[model samples]
Target: MNLEISIIVPDRIFLRDNAHTIILPTLTGQMGVLTNHIPLLTGLDTGLILVRKSVSSDWIGVVVTGGFALVNDNKITILVNEAELGSEINAEEAEMAFLAAKSALENASDEKRKIEINSQFKKARARLVCFNSIV
Candidate 1:
């Protein structure tokens, strides 16, 4: 049985489809969901959401920033502040953003600014990684 996955962002829905499996970045670590997986509700980290369908068995990647994930009755729903599909990511632009965030993080003196910059850096880095994985 395939699992239905949906990723929702404030502005738009990033993905909605069926997949054999999904791997998501959780606060504790990466978690993989499959058919009949136990129900879960967890905080997400800035990282990649990997989806794999059984038909072709190719992985689709989506970079998502801080959010939450819910799994119930063979459906997975992800709610994120921001999400970008691997196909939509531009590697060069992502690299530039990553570098800029890194620089800002290094220069941030206040704890709050540093925290924000660090999150940016993580998101940018995840974007680059996910972009590279797309065929």
Candidate 2:
């Protein structure tokens, strides 16, 4: 049976795929879903959301910083603060951003700005990790 799932972000819609199962990175831990999964809504974390298609054993990885996921009626929808695919990441650019964020945390003047940069660094790192998984 086909399962429908959609992942939407602020700037764009990342995905809408029919699959067999999905795994989400939640605030507390990861979640796995299959056909006929009970409805759920919860806050997310910065990490990978793994997708498995019944067609094969291959897994697709998606990264999101924050947001919520909903599942009902054999459908899944993820509205995320930010999301990116594994293949889209530029490792060098992500590393650069990470370093810049680290510097901001040290030399920056504004506490909130520093925290925001640090959070971006974490998200970028998570993307890098997700990218590695796809390769």
lDDT of 1 at 116: 77
Q: Ten-residue segment with the worst summed lDDT in candidate 1? A: 126-135
Off by over 4 Å in 2: 99-114
In order, the Cα lDDT scores of the candidates are: 0.91, 0.83
Best by TM-score: 1
lDDT of 2: 0.83
RMSD of each predicted structure: 1.5, 2.5
Give a tens-digit lDDT track for model 2, residues 23-70. 898989988889988888888888789888885778888888888988
TM-score of 2: 0.81
Write one digit per residue (lDDT tens) for candidate 1, span 1-135. Answer: 889998999988878999999999999999999899999999999999999998578899999988999999999999999888898888899889988988899999999999878888999889888988885
Give the clash count for each candidate. 0, 0
Residue-level lDDT for 49 in candidate 2:
91
lDDT of 2 at 77: 89
